[model samples]
Target: MKNSIFNTILVTLSVSLLLLLGGCAKTIVPPTDTSAMATGSDLEYPESHNTGTMGEAGFSEDNLPLEGSLDDNSHSFNDTDIMNMPEAFRREHGRSSEGFLPVYFEFDQFRLSPEMMVVIEQNAAYMQSNPAINLILEGNCDERGTAEYNLALAERRAINVKRYLTNTGIPENHIRTISYGEERPLFLGHDEKAYKYNRRVDFIAE
Candidate 1:
């Protein structure tokens, strides 16, 4: 009788152990990706309607707003920020840069292609009409290269675009250049198409 009781107890303990392990297995989770986050920015995905070249990725606080993000209520205000003006700023960079057309770039190259040249000409026309509007020549890259290299490359792209603009009479002071490096990408896919979209510069109004 004692042996019978002992066997039953062992069976019960085994069942309990199996249940515990199963529970633990169900609770286990994979690690999260924190690379997309900027310093002091929220660890989770931010609530953004930004569907620019970055596509669905939110521009963390580290990105700031190129130069032209304005407060929600007004237009062409330099100190105004976009967050305060999310209502329409999402549609256009707003503030100093309303009606500005943001351009995309190819991966790892700083030269504006023939198509990009057309964009630059359009911007030249708008800026010529609106002198107080400062330009933010923001550059971005994909996640393939070293961080430092990507940053330098992005800067170069911005410079390249600025050179074109300068030749077209856009003053040096009118455009400010910034490089986001490989820290931002339009799509998270590891492919040629996504990489191409990421390796470009953005134009913001200040």
Candidate 2:
């Protein structure tokens, strides 16, 4: 019994020593791969993504845009881009129309009326203050002309206004053109007064 107890104590000491040694074992990590790999257009591409533009806000995560790129150039945003932008983002929206003038056109034609020089002066003032005002012209026509022809004429009128604005120093990029034709008459009458008012253009913010 004495020999057995001595042997058992020795065995316990050895087991404990083995377990303590194991607790201090060091973990070894393999070296990472470091080779001349390609990148920045040189690397193999996995697959392409189709980025799209937004109808409301221009850009949003829901679009699932590609890694990075311009989606489209269809924004009809004008001076109103500044006005329509949320208050928090108004500062970076584009330009202000504080001193800019509201341009005017002729009575029967879409061309800038000779009397509109004052209106252009006002627009020039507005432009002086706003500096970055984007202009969108929506040409309109009276009910005297046919719908289709009127649409084309209205477009021409808007284009004519834009051309003149550009001649006045406004950048062409800042002005966009569209026509309303005879569809949207300003006055509800067949008289010359109403026709005069209807044959005009409107500015829209994107």
Candidate 3:
């Protein structure tokens, strides 16, 4: 009877120990989806995804219109206003030489404006009235651009003016074109006002 009770007690303690060991054993947590964990890194670091140029990847400030550009309304008046006036009035205005007007261009553009066309019309009429008169169209530019670029731009300005004058009946042989680039500035100051004055094509009777 004593042996039977000891064996039963040993068996109950062995069962309890087995249950405690099982309870203490660490629960096996299956490996998580590591792909999902890595998805957040791309959002956290932006430069990692950089392919190359700003234009290729996304928007850039260079693509936007510059603030306070010359195109703003404040600079509405063009050089033609002062240049294309009558000889008597121009002398009073004290801006241009006798019987001719200077033509001006916007920053970085070779295209002639409506005001420029009007000035050219008056110039054409003057040349028509005086058949012996020959004119030299001197192209110029502002101080902002590179020397080579400005030279090319000035050439375009002069050529365009010459073309228009020829189209208006001034003989092509009568007009000569020259580019001074930024070397000859009509206005000496460095502001936009000065730049506006500098970017011009002056007409000198040769």
- Candidate 2 lDDT by residue in tens digits, 1-206: 99999999999999999999999998532211223111211111121421111122222123322221112232334534545566444322222233333343333333344555445555655665676667666666667545555565566556655655676777778777766667655455898756655666555444
Q: Which candidate has the highest TM-score of all?
A: 3
Q: Write one digit per residue (lDDT tens) for candidate 3, span 1-206.
A: 99999999999999999999999987532222222111112232233432111222112222222122122222112456755655455322223346877787776565566677788889889899999977777777788656655665666667767878887889988877777777666566898777766778777675
- 183, model 3: CA deviation in Å? 0.4
lDDT of each: 0.56, 0.49, 0.61
Score residue 201 of candidate 3 by CA lDDT.
79
> Residue 50 of candidate 2: its Cα lDDT?
12
lDDT per residue (tens digit) for residues 86-194 in model 1: 5444323322255665555554344455676777788888889988887777666777655655665566566667777887898888777777677645445797755
RMSD of each: 13.6, 25.5, 26.2
Better of 1 and 3 by lDDT: 3
**Candidate 1, residue 44: lDDT:** 20
Kindly provide the TM-score of model 3 when superposed on the true structure, using C-alpha atoms: 0.55
Query: Model 3, stretches more than 4 Å misplaced?
Result: 1-96
TM-score of each: 0.52, 0.48, 0.55
Task: Return the TM-score for candidate 1, rounded to 2 decimals.
Answer: 0.52
Residue 110 lDDT (model 1): 45
